[model samples]
Target: MMNRARITRVGALAAASALAIGGLTACQSGGGESSGGDVTITWWHNSTSDPLKSLWADVASEFEADHPGVTVKVEGYQNEELQRTLIPNALRSGGGVDLFQAWGGGEIKDQVAAGYVKDISDAAADTIEAVGPVVSGWQVDGKTYGLPFQYGIEGFWYNTDLFAEAGIDAPPTTLDELYTAIDKLKAAGITPIAVGAGDKWPAAHYWYNFALKSCSPDTLKEAQSQLVFDDPCFVEAGELLQEFIDSEPFQDGFLATSAQQGAGSSAGMLATGKAAMELMGHWNPGVMGGILKDDAGQDDATPPEFLGWFNFPGIDGTAGDPTAALGGGDGFACAQWAPDECVELLEYIESEDVQSRFGEIGAGIPVLPAAASSITDPNLQQVLEGLQSASYVQLWLDTAYGPTVGGAMNDGIVALFGGQGTPEDIVKAMQDAAATL
Candidate 1:
């Protein structure tokens, strides 16, 4: 359980902070002269933190150094804002930026359909062979549009200290044991788990994880594509999700809390020994290390260590293994309206050396296996191990559903949490939405 903030949560008007974090040296207005080459590319991102900033900047520098005539003007956008306005502006005015980051699933499809994103299938195919899973997940309509810049394996992140205090030997490995452990933690006067349902995406994680464990990878993929919510597997998954939420294991005020607040609360709970576990991603290390340390005014030289993780366990009777993971990340995208120079810049961002440098900063798991192996960080190694062993990887539910229907799923989950709806009702709602899409 790491006490950290996600850059993706930063609102749209907060783009100034995002850009500053990128550390772009060159400023290019609509008609600025390039230092050497006549080509200048505009790059946009959604990262405002160190590793992501350093990782992307490293790639940009490499791109400029290698291609003497081209320069990259990078801008950072809040993830939420980027989807809201930047996309429309890109499609209409085409002045937003030449390249931006995008999630691979339904968002990619929607953007491509809107005529805002370029078709990089031909450009990405050969390179994807080298990058593997990073690129594999980005493909749509038999074509690829972007290269994966980052990846995180989805699973439960737990607190070892809390586990020991509760006399729980290890993280649960099956559905029954999972419930038993939650009850044990509850008996010990601790919240069994910390969750954020304020943002539907986080709540959807549970449902999707259940779907992942309940069905074959192919079925999940089809469900994502056809928007088939009525599938028995998904219904079963929804029922399980309701069971967890309806039970008294979750922390108080969970439904009333916002995503950011819940994350901070969860981190605090774990860091201070109040909770046993949380379900989160790899990006948490920086958050917990930075925010919680300062809150206590402890010596800057040494910070408390209170972090650990485990993969999401499988349902006992499910065909999928516990090691099965959900994998997806943001990526640099080439705008269809962008000039060739911009496309070139994006291609460089995916290069081996550049990607390796990104890994050095721990911004993300390098999509290229070779580059990922070059990273020496132990936590990153843990994430890499999770990805490498995953029998099958499921993409984020929001990513898979695209925006419109995904939003609906989120609402349904929130409603489920308030006891206003049933799991079958929620699943049917999503399935109905899927049928139209």
Candidate 2:
């Protein structure tokens, strides 16, 4: 197994800059370097650990085998580090980075506008055909620039034992019922929802999903493209989300907990019967699995039995359908200055074989439906089924909005949780931000 921490060794092929050693002359080939028969292509990503990193290496090796004599130098960075330093630095023309990953939306779209990335429509035609409409999510300006690679949808995770103990018959299917369920769980001395407001992004998720549930996909799409924030749908969504937070369903001190701390704490609470539910993504299975395994010693190690999930229920009589989903995920974006070898590398990654391998390694859900059939992991299968049930899918609010829109939503959410803002106050802030955008 490839340890994710060893990415610098196996993932990175080029250092900060290329060097010219004495008498070891090298010419710039299609991907970047040409020495003998080696075609070194610079590939960058943000997945730096665990099964996700391991799966990527397996795919890279397969790609190498498919194209004899071509070696992909897969470089990786930690999520925050990549966004803050590596990506900005790589944007300089001729930086030796041919391909990299980005959270698809304004960030990548802005890159497209700046001419920093390539339009891979023709190169990815076959992939689009094989991957189906799911690939369209990454398209911009009538051009397909990247592949919808690894992805997972967001939803609510709950403790099955807690539900049974509270005499809850089923997971809530509507907001009213959801609150009722929460009340029942609270009476049993368990927090109904576990929220980590400390990490601004996690707090942002609640507001984002609430907006998605109240708005139509087309309206949200328009808002994303134009950076519009004041759309009535947004106000309605913000208000809905604020009400949930105000219900006092989250555990005490949730407002003070950081996202990192909240994730483990929330899962721990569920496992030890401290909380009944958590809003999370499919990737959480691995975290939950690791925690459960560690809690049980050696031969006695087994996953907790109470773990399960449900989509965040929809608001009744709202414009949004009950089946709409909110999601955020990673995808590849080609540098506009990329050489042929770099483009070829992307084509290879999008192929059915590579997509199928993604599932086998347990790296969340593969974006391609055909690839979903090959995932042998039962838990991932459950996740895929849940995703397929959605009537519509909305990009995560932060990824879908400009920094201003996202920031306002994040601040409004934190303020609401801290008891310093009202539903009207939050909605007004969102509307004001959208108006400026």
Candidate 3:
């Protein structure tokens, strides 16, 4: 029988709607070799927030100290920007950063198929085993192309104080209960949900979670690999999302709000108590903590105690299990032509000591089992429990489907949120986009 972690290896989607704006072309065939003497490993990651950002710098410095004649040059970019633009451009250009951020799904598969990423199976075998099967998203045909350092599940991050104000005694566990809570919050003059629809992927997550509840695992798996969406559940997901929209649960002008930007963003809304809840992954606390500030606009030393979480509610009479979940993790992959030290740096990042420190600093939900004990945040602990107990985990839909189809699906979902599209529109868009792939 497979281990618990192995059973939890299910994949999730990523954020990259920019592929629709400007096409993400296939990577070129060949890349230039790294320079010889005085080697430098260029590492790029999406750790723009504090502590984690500084923590990465410290990790790089430590690596350089241990290995003579090598320099680890690290650069950080915002998550959406890095995934949607920088990384895609680098892969197409074929000779840039040595190691860059990767989510390991259809995206990495595209890079691997195009010969843009290296196969690190033999090079980092020990580290791969240590990380365990949660790295499944990073593998293709049993060959490892990247290493996942953080893995987690998605759920609703709520403001407990606000929930009490709205008279919601307990978090909703079913679709009917969720709608009731939304109505109650509205009656109490509160914005029930805060969504960053300006960033298309955030809005797309709504449709994705609904699909997870509506479709069977076998149906979802077939759709991921074959891009087939003939199942009625696909349309059912859109209808469910539309019903939620009809309840007017989200904040006003949500379409203009970014996911994680400033005080006006979705994360900011939750942090500032402007909204009651947000649908986000386990990484929410770290990002939310970074953006939270005092009256003087300086970073707050303490995390918001009002922050709480609950699983996405299950739809009644669905083929999907209520225990099923949707999520994925952050990983890094070496460029095809990066220096040998690139693999070494990957191994170093996943070491027990570093991963434990990563958890201690609240960087993310560490994938290393030994480091699990270091996680003290109750909100993150809730996410960990959900991940461990999930009947089947599904990767983010966009991530599971790759760039072309994923991009189209995101655009289609965003159109629905804007009141310009319908359930059939999203299904048709996906079907059309899949035909190309």
Candidate 4:
């Protein structure tokens, strides 16, 4: 759910005009009304695995039991498929979903502009207040369109046992130490990092972290608002990522490897001890746990142990604060034609009790401040701590910048990884796309 870009004033005005028109058309089409007869709210989410899949179903059933004549139909799809294909197609057609998963940054903004989503500010006001500032990602012009149930920062997830075997005493805190650790891991015949470059977004994350190291929060914000990448740091991010790529630190056939699929995927490699570490969001453990299950779907006896986390190492001469972070969250938004019940469902999911349950199950780092105590996983706790202490948290590049620029930036980054592009190429790709905006 992470991505990139800034938008120009002209582009902003254009988008705003489109949003107003779309909103008007949506209202004219009876967007907020419930069908008079049996009402079925279609919920689309990307939790295609258990226990999250089952947890969501259970929640839906509970909601259905409490409300007569309302049926909740929950559908699950793979993350990439939903994001890159299903949701886009559905939104374009202006149907097919009532409540759908939303990432709450530029993606939501784009959807809002296209008139694919509804503004639930008044309906979810109490929930928004409880969630606090984290909901800003889902707001446009100070109006809420969605509610975040889970949020977290990205970092390296490493195997303590692997680090020990590589003769590393502690997680590296600086870039030099990180490179040293990478060399040491390689010397021990272990893949230093597990990246799913085949899944372009996972590969794009490396460049994003480098940007976080080289650009200050204010500079990033300015770029986001203006859709401009005039700063040298943006290209420097590409250069830094290229240096890492040249180290041959990733798994073999990494360009073809998926990010979170089965045993051959990046998370699978880390879970099954085929690699030393992976750079992923707070959701890594749940994905890894899913991969570690036995044939009968029970937890494996040797499920990943001594799992640890560390912030992305800082470069020595970077302008950005070392403590700044890159991250975002998962939320649900109602389609413009969805019933009022859709908003109710979102509020139900964000309630403190439900969010606490979500934390207890390690679904993700809960967005509810009070649910922080319910988090028991050590690795997730580390992510939570890093997020709370960050000097500033930049939304994922592709997400902050919206689709066009973010997609171009991601393509350019993966091209660099594949040795098909350069740092300048990455910047050029984004600049070119921004121009269109």
Candidate 5:
């Protein structure tokens, strides 16, 4: 996630909003290739923050040290700019990027269809096998295209201290209960929620959760492949989101707030104790820490002691499984023209040792099962527990829906948040966008 503006691999809820970071400079460079036994692998990812950023840099240097005559150039960019603009443009323009951020789902599908990404099924087989079924998001027709390093489910990241102050003894389990908590927070003069509506996806996730609760698992699965919005549950999802917004729980001028900037972003609001909670992905703690550190210009800052989490509240009457979850993870894909070392680098990144450190860093939930013990953070471990206990996990809606439809759907949801659109309008937007495909 661009410093907290743009992303999901449901670690998807991990980053900030892409739209919120308008000045994400594109540091475009050609895929590094040299003759005479010399190789350079250029890697791009959406991690412009600590722990993950330094970790990737160190990994690149380590890889270079391991292989003679090999130089790896690794870089980080804001999530949205890299995913939505830089990466795609680089792929289409050809040869500008080698290894880069890949958020599976429809984005990778479209890339594969356009002959932009390499078929890594045969190349990174062991890494693919190690990550197991989570790799499916990066696959199309049973062929692997990208690999995930961190995978997790979405939930509300709240301030436990604020909960106490508001007299919310326990996190809510149902929609009505969540409303009660919100009302209680308000009674205590606290902003119950912080949403980066300025960044569309953060706000859109409310609808994603609503849809995850409203639609049956099979219907969501079908929608992923068909892009059809005929199901009434989809409409119901929007209605629920509308009702939640009508409750006026978010901080003032939330529509202008970014996701991961400094102290003013939605994540920032939660980080600074200015708001009670935020709905975000597994990478939230790291994002919050990064925001606080950047704000203070410090070497490190950790998630506050008051931070807490709970899965999205269920709607009792909904067709979807109450235990079902919404999620995604950050991943990597090599450009079609990238050299074989690109695959080698991908493998190294997902290697047990590297991924163990990934888990240890508390940046996000490591995807490899063997590295599970490395996840020492209590909160991140809780996310792992949620991922394990989920009756089913739905990939983030925009991601599962792919770029065209997903982009349209996100825009429509954000429009709803801004009071300019309706639930049915989101369905129509998805349909129109899907029609073009």
Candidate 6:
């Protein structure tokens, strides 16, 4: 596999890397068309909550209204379940799913290899071109397999009111400072950070951030291309994670907490002011708002007025560039066997109007270069500013490395979080998985 290092900026949206891969078995779809010439394409995505959930539903309706005979059966599922199980099973059987969430990276590459995804390069060329290099992750070789709608770096989403109550003045810019803030928050009887350990990926991201700060850009590129992890920095990432875990900054019972499931999940903790901060992505504000809406049972639910964001603090001494960031986007792809309407629906989803609405509501960073003006949300604006200043931006480690190796890596990282694994274990796990490929 070639190193997909070529990065391009899509207006304000930064270019991000791709996702995971896996071999899949083939079968037939449960349904796609009726005998009367009516087309029904099933759409599956990870936005079971409000805001994004409603946005997607409305988009589906608009698509149906424009195309008289076409029906889009859109549904939202939990992210992990959708990405890890349902979609893969549907694809393996060639049933149920027509258009589904496609996180660009090694994941789509594997789907392409299995001949399960449509080559949308021709069908959605205009939208792809409009999004520019930011769509890099969703492409395989040189062809587009999927298209991203949300792309931005991960950072600390904090409750400003809680920060003030804890007597923390500003966001930390270095590891030591973050530790100090953590101490202050703890002294003030507050949980400093919320990690959804039960989900694995959320807790695993701590090591991902540490690796971003510990490894050099060249080392990361070489490792991804060669699937090698001999460098000591990889182990140091786990060491740093272990130290952070030792700090015990997360809330109690965090190991079983879901990331965004309900009012008790990680995002829910931050949304309800039960926690001071959460390390999450640009789309988190939407997730938080959706959580609040669900928990409060009110239509006027919005992200906390005192919500704030800051980049993950840099470690004082590391080979990794302090300016490097970790991020990626969410996109969609058409099943290889789906009707042509599948691609048309993708076109509508990435259209300027739809993308603009995405930005306006803080669902995520819109991919369209022209949709930048629609973002009035201050937190997302801060994220874009950080993206502009970042000297390098890496896709989420689990995503950039693809599924097989990334899965092993996360497993090891989560083990460390639970005090059952060591720093070396995580690197070894990744190395072992890479060896198979």
TM-score of each: 0.83, 0.81, 0.91, 0.91, 0.92, 0.92
Predicted candidate 2 versus true structure: per-residue lDDT over 1-437, tens digit per residue: 22345456324424533331222333333333543476766788876544566567776787788778777778666554576446755674346577788677766776777777788888767776776666655778878877768677888878888898988998887888999998898888777887667666777788778878777777777777766555677777767876777688888887666432222556555655677887887766554554444442323223356677788887877777678788766788777766666667777777677778777766578877777877866656766776788777787777677566677877887887777877667767766888885
lDDT by residue for model 6 (1-437), tens: 11121111121112111112334445564654543478998999888766888899999999999888888898887677678777887787877789999888778888999998999888788888999988888888899988998889999999999999999998999999999999999999999998888999999998999999999999998887777899999999988988998999999988888897668889989988899999999988888887778675657658878899999999887999999999989999998888888888999998999999989878878878899889899999999888879999898888778889999999998889888978988888898899898
Worst 10 residues of 4 by lDDT: 1-10
CA lDDT, candidate 2, residue 312: 82
Q: Give the per-residue lDDT digits (tens) of candidate 4, residues 29-79.
A: 333455556688889898866667778999999999988888999977777
lDDT (tens digit, per residue) of candidate 3 on 1-437: 22232123211112334453576565554444454567888899987666788889999999999888889889778786678777877777776688999998899998899898989999999999989989899999999999999999999999999899999999999989999999999899989999999989999999999999899999999999888999999999999999888888999999999897777889889988999999988888777777774221655535578999999998889888789999999999999888888898999999999999988877578999989998888888889999999989999999999878999999999999999989999999999998886
**CA lDDT, every model vs. true structure:** 0.68, 0.70, 0.86, 0.85, 0.87, 0.86
Q: How many collisions per candidate? A: 4, 5, 6, 10, 14, 15
Candidate 3: segments with Cα more than 4 A from true spot:
1-36, 294-298
Q: Candidate 6, after superposition: displacement of residue 329 in Å?
A: 0.3
lDDT (10s digit) by residue, model 1, range 297-353 = 434312125566677777877755567798688787787766666656766677777
Give the number of the best model, judged by lDDT.
5
Query: Which RMSD does model 5 reach against the true structure?
Result: 5.2
Query: Can you tell me which runs of candidate 2 are displaced by over 4 Å?
Result: 1-37, 65-71, 92-96, 260-274, 290-305, 376-379, 424-437
For model 4 the TM-score comes to: 0.91
Give the TM-score comparing model 2 with the true structure, all chains together. Answer: 0.81
- Those runs of model 1 whose alpha carbons end farther than 4 Å from true positions after fitting are 1-40, 58-71, 121-126, 260-274, 293-304, 319-322
How high is the lDDT of residue 426 in model 1?
Answer: 75
Residue ranges of candidate 5 with Cα displaced over 4 Å: 1-36, 297-299
